[model samples]
Target: MSPAITETMIYDALRKVIDPELRHDIVELGFIQEIDIVDDYVHLEIQLTTPNCPYAENIVAQIKRAVEGVDGVHRVEVERACMKGS
Candidate 1:
């Protein structure tokens, strides 16, 4: 298999995505679970602290924008998943 995307870069990009309600980057809040990059497309699985997270959509959009802003990224796909104990 090819080398996986660097987790540091992924986390850095995610730092640009902030949660409106929390007024903080999701990365700092431990929201991002995984990131996969393939053929210049970024796939992200994000975990929200709550199932009814008020800023879920906004956070996803922000994450998409942040990832897409990366130099080699052609597309960004972000999926929101609820945290188990949330």
Candidate 2:
């Protein structure tokens, strides 16, 4: 049996996803807004610098790939997090 997927593992996987313009891992930039394990799927919320950030699609893709590559992650869902009070 595979080890259960924990939030730490998810965070570790996300470290591999880098922001091209910032040249930093998305985790370090605090882009991971939320993480929830519902049954076999992992739901993730990513906070972007802005609602209209041009790299939204690409960054999301990268995050998907990174999180899904983790051993016990059966699925991944990504969405943008709204800015505080906005």
Candidate 3:
């Protein structure tokens, strides 16, 4: 069986990714909608408070960097989604 992805690892990695506007980690801000690991790749669905948020690209880049730092991660794929309300 494949090893499970621990919540602690996920949270720790995500904590390194900050939301520029909120001045807090994306995990703390609750912007990470979901995380999925398949093989060695990590897929992330990230939700921003607004569709037109100025820091969207920066946030995505930071998230990719953070996730890629994990020991078993070979690639990081991040998809952006807009939150229901800003």
How many clashes would you count in candidate 1? 0
Among the numbered candidates, top lDDT falls to: 2
- lDDT digits (tens) for residues 7-68 of candidate 1: 67778888987788788888898898888878778888888878888877877888888877
TM-score of 3: 0.85
Root-mean-square deviation (CA) per prediction? 3.3, 1.1, 2.6
Error of 1 at 70 (Å): 0.2
Residues 1-86 of candidate 2: C-alpha lDDT, one tens digit per residue: 66888899899999998888888999999999899986668999889878888888999999889888888777899989898878
| CA lDDT of each prediction against the hidden true structure | 0.79, 0.88, 0.81
- lDDT (tens digit, per residue) of candidate 3 on 1-86: 44556556777999988777788888888888888887778888888888889988888888888887777777889998766754
The global Cα lDDT (0 to 1) of model 3 is: 0.81
Q: Give candidate 3 misplaced runs (Cα > 4 Å).
A: 1-5
Worst 10 residues of 1 by lDDT: 1-10
lDDT of 3 at 51: 89
Q: After superposition, how far is residue 45 of candidate 1 from its true place, in Å?
A: 0.5
